[model samples]
Target: MAEDLNIHDADPVEEFLPVYGMVLADPALYHLAVSVGETLDRGDRWAGAIRRQLTHAVAAHLLGTYTRLKPAPETVRGGLAPWQLRRAQDRIRADLAQAIDLRAVSESCGLSVSHFARAFRQSTGIAPHSWLTGERIARAKVMMRRKDRTLADIALACGFADQSHFTRAFAKNQGTTPGRWRRLMEPEARHATMP
Candidate 1:
């Protein structure tokens, strides 16, 4: 298996099939086969339901890989190490409300900014700016719990330049305005109490 291809990734088969030529792994699609073997070994004659579940899991796990195993691209190789990833995430969390400086992050990791950006993308599958935006949105979601907090205040706290910017970004990511999301939260509480 290619180093970049996680069996649990969204599309493992497609990921592996591309690098099938360069890879040294056998083409038997062993993961699914092993799953079936283990499932049958339970030896319960009445295990039909369990067998069905195991089959479904195996199918989902081997999706796309059976026919077209592939190799990972050279450029995608060598992502940040575990510690570096933790450090980078920590730094991003620390400055969630501020503009992240790529140069500063790279310097902190002892890597050039461009190198850091490439490795970060390969490792995380998203750009640093995109990740920062996602983090901001997540933070906004948490802060939205305070029903009394104005959207503008939440926006500023989450590092949006202003209320309009925050609303636009929030709407873009969340498929609704902050006010609407907040309203949805309150109804959940009402439903919980009723139940």
Candidate 2:
């Protein structure tokens, strides 16, 4: 004599009992659930299909987690602020090997020179010039590792003006000369790579 319940109200606890039980045992089903959520959000049929596949993957992940197996570590939280900084940082990073103007960096962020320097230092915990120097040195290290590049070339490419200037700056910032760093990175690359 009772009215029938709709699909959404069909005693989900009872209906999902089999699924929950299976997922609990499998420890991987949670990933499948997360993927399904993502797929639904993408607003594309193909995404939905991909989500269906990921639903299975999520299930497997959940199964592993529930079982106390080696579930993947949680991803670090990233947010919009870092993304905004990344856009500006990309420009700075690209021009590190050149004569970087602090004013330009500030202008890029729509701030005046002094205001930009202060904000940048506050956010990055280093002065803009220091940050730029570090970036240049990091790039030089990458170039030095290639072995095809000479210390002089690296110095020039990294905007040190001359080999002596590069050596002094590298030593000041990196605690070693460019040549020494390259040797430490690749002992075999010594003669063949040096200019």
Candidate 3:
């Protein structure tokens, strides 16, 4: 039907059928019928227009049948409940400086690792590992404000194994090296202290 009617995303038919009953409640058909009458009165290309409208009118029914025939995909299990999500986030935040075990994390939520991972992604719109990394980066940014701390110290404190690992992760997350980010923050820090 799409090929027959030349329906494109930019120029597509909008569904005007809201009611479902024994008869099709097609407001689109009514609108098109009115348009055809108006075009006929003006002596325009009413024939061609009516043909296109008829194609859409037929295609709508065909698509409705297609929808009815197609089997729906089985949805994954429900997302972590709100309390479960909060508990997971708290656990992640508390253990941000330590190595995370997926099994352990999932167990805390009373779920299998696969289910927990899927539900975590569903709740947060990010994979668990990615969310963890982002949290680690956020922690690093807060520690970065202190000029006394070395990058190596900050790295280990924020759950990264080494300075190089920290640098790569921080660069990817912040779009700059940690040292550069610190340097940029210095002026802002200095200004904040003044009256």
lDDT scores of the candidates, listed in order:
0.69, 0.58, 0.70
> Model 3: per-residue lDDT, tens digit, 1-195?
654432321112321212222466567667756765655655457676776776676566555542222221223368887678778877888888887688888899999999999998876666888878877977787788777789999999999989999999988876679888777766656567989
Question: lDDT of model 2 at residue 84?
Answer: 41
Worst 10 residues of 1 by lDDT: 12-21
Candidate 1: misplaced stretches above 4 Å? 1-76, 189-195
* Preferred candidate (TM-score higher): 1 or 2: 1
- Candidate 1, 92-162: lDDT as tens digits: 87978889988878888889999899888887777888778867977887788777689899999989999
Question: Which sequence of candidate numbers ranks them by TM-score, best first?
Answer: 1, 3, 2
**Candidate 3 residue 111 C-alpha distance from true site, Å:** 0.8
RMSD of each: 11.6, 18.1, 18.1
Predicted candidate 3: what Cα RMSD to the true structure? 18.1
Q: Estimate each model's TM-score.
A: 0.60, 0.51, 0.56
Clashes of each: 12, 18, 0
